[model samples]
Target: MRRERVRRPSGAVPPSPFVRRGRPAGAQQDTEADPARAGTMGSKQIAQETFDEAVQENITEFEMEPEEAVREAVLQFESQGVDLSNIVKAVRPPASENGQRQKHQILLTLESLAGAVAERDAARLPQPLAALAAQCREQLALRCLAGRHGAYPAVLSACQLAAGDRQLLLQALAALAALLDGQPDLLDAAGRELLLRSLREQQDAEVTLAGIRCVRHACLKHEHNRQAFVQGGVLPVLTGAIARHGSAAELVRTAASALRVMTFDDDIRVPFGHAHDHAKMIVLENDGLRVLIEAAKAFTDNSAVLSELCATLSRLSVRNEFCQEIVDLGGLNFMVTLLADCMEHPDVVRQVLGAIRAVAGNDDVKDAIVEAGATELIVLAISHHLGQPQICEQGCAALCMLALRKPENCSVIMEGGGALAALQAMRAHPREVAVQKQACMLIRNLVSRSRELCGPILALGAEGLIAEARAAHRDCDDVARAALRDLGCKVELRELWTGQKGGLAQ
Candidate 1:
């Protein structure tokens, strides 16, 4: 393949990678007249010109192996963070031309780079190799995006083992993944397919980690990418990635990060489209939560690992049946036990409390939870993390959910000093509407009847706080007003009835 170039006029400054948009090539002006500075700038420009010329010679000349010369040119381009866009465009075969020779040359170059990655797959790259690999990655990313010699599709095809030498397949796939990211419009389906395949079948932790990284980037800023991932069965592969490394923390962390992203989206499938949530069911039956539990246990000392595991579980516990699945998997008990053991770590406590709230929100689940002594843990979490409004909100919401129609649940809260916990949360976070609302709702449900639990709420003087915070939760003001009504004060219902007359009532 030959690279084309236009001859420059006299004294015309050549384009360098250091050239910025507004700054013309070699337009640098320095006020300082120091000879040292002038010498430095001159040396840099000379060195850059020397490097560019050498790269051009490598690409245009056929003296060396075509693949080796192309690889060397890429390394030179990457050393200075150079932009090969113009050079690539200048040299690329025309679309109308049947340039099989040029395309073949491009494929050879890709295979060479991929084989390098494979050579270093089993262990960390040495400094020199790591530098070369980083440069290779940066160059490949640019080349993939530049559409060189039909490079995009070629790179995509290289993901398959049968594309060429089987030894280089995983490396090629991994390299392609680093390029597929931030390109959802182009790579959503194809990228996800490649990633899922790599994660499920590769069995190499490096390949799985690479796939996990791609999954994170593909899902960035695109809902369609997430749908594509689920549609392509990313969850099953993710579980495979989690268990693939046999306790390698780096691989586990990467896989866990991918799981964290997978569960981050609140809407995995359309609500009314399927009764069973086929995608979620896939995750559940694959023992996804069980894998999370294992990760949480295996990485008890890693705050990041514990945090991601708890976050994934918290998201799963949003739905009713999933909450039960969490309990069945011992997730609820596991989280409470984690809180008891790691209260000093705020991140763990925050996620654990969030998960606990999500799991212990139903009538039956709350009963089992309170019976299992989660009520005390909830109160303790509230007390320990009062400065964390999210923790307080989840704790208070759990209390409200627990006491909804079960006075026995309210009795549990009262006996466990959860009423005081709610009061402390209200006082500490007076400005947080969520905390105030849940705290008020819990108190209202408690005093809604005489379950021998109203005394503690009344004794704590929660009525005024609940009433004052009524406007914070217009959606559930009835609960607040009812608590006031129960305290010998039938709060006005005029606004509650007629407030909807206005457009903003909703």
Candidate 2:
């Protein structure tokens, strides 16, 4: 008797030998449902299948869970009577109250493997190497969770292994990192290649972290690291990470470091918001500055990176040859926009103020920063409810710096109604005594540098000025004494009190 065949509820039917051998009319649609199988069976299937098979075989050996593999490997090493206590001792973090160090246990196992690998002791190495790679992969996976402490130590252990069993160890680390972690550490070609050669196998978020961190550290240590980044096929990878993994703090820091490295030379500087002008020498614009500018503007997860970039840009702006780029990138406008939104981030404000100070050293940039309402913002910052003493101090110093560059900015400060605020701050509180001293010094500088700045200082009224001078003189504070001398008090004004000389006209 003939029996009806069972079909999948989704309407899939079993394929006959002939149907599998030859493509049916609707075979393409059916195959599309199982993408992997369909690709292997299609026209390009021969090459695709070969490639996929190789990848799967590699992953099978390398992409296993790392922590378990490492523990097992360590136990196996100990079963063979290997002593790893000393290696563990060198790398152990400070012991806690319980005296039970879980990390030390893992580290001891990995270090044992590393030592065996380094000594070319094959019997002691293989199992531990395999376990180390697996632990790296497991740690990488854990990055999705909040606690990621054990990752770096594992990587260092793997790197040690890579130094010995070049082929086995390095390949193991790369496979594990690629599959399990997007960490910045293991992304560089040299680092990845090194890892790929020595590591047994595993994954880690730290692989990405390692790659970026290696590149960054190299840049910090010497110029050769920068060349390595360019030659290692890592730049595109790092830049791509920034675009796609913008949320990762490690990735963002890596991108900034890479950009900074490339920006060292004038030819590459144009890509990072800087260039060279015939007249002014260096100029950066649009995307060049925008990467960092956008980073600074993000203001949420990566504000530290933003602050660093801002400080770097500020330094660049102050270089006489680089001022043109600052102008071209709409820096003045950006600075103003940040002032309105970034009141909570004092570091950002400090950076913006510094950049302003740099660019504003030139008359045109100064006017632009001021015109962008920097003067008004400075006044607002001085009186912010948070009432940061440093903000007032910096505000006073920035005005002094601005007044030195453009006498008109001091007038803008006065017009923005900061004069009374500056005066009030001079005696705000005991904690604000330092700020008060800065205010008095700034007014003195304004009056001494140009009579025009004195117009506003005097506009605050003579009685208040005399009271400030008396406070400075009688307070026994060094800052107050210096400020008293700086207020343009003539010897005639001093000697009249002593009666050694006739009183001058009022």
Top candidate, metric TM-score: 1
| Residue 380 accuracy (lDDT) in model 1 | 88
- The residue-by-residue lDDT of candidate 2 on 1-506, one tens digit each, is 32332222423555422121112223322111111122123222122122222223223344423343344333433453433221121122334789653343445555575576457565565566556545444543223111123334444445555554445544444433432243443234445445332211322334555445445543432333345545444445554555555566665665556555444542221243321221112123323354555554454445566656656566455355455556666656667776667877887777766666666666666666666678888777767733666667777766766665466666777677666666766546435555666676666555654565554566676336445544555442444444444555432233326655677779
Against the reference, the lDDT scores of all candidates come to 0.61, 0.49
Q: Pick the candidate with the highest lDDT.
A: 1
Question: Which ten contiguous residues of candidate 2 have the minimum total lDDT?
Answer: 30-39
Tell how far residue 133 is off in model 2, in angstroms: 14
Off by over 4 Å in 1: 1-186, 263-279, 318-321, 449-451, 471-479, 486-488, 495-506
Per-model TM-score versus the true fold: 0.61, 0.47
Model 1 lDDT vs. the true structure? 0.61
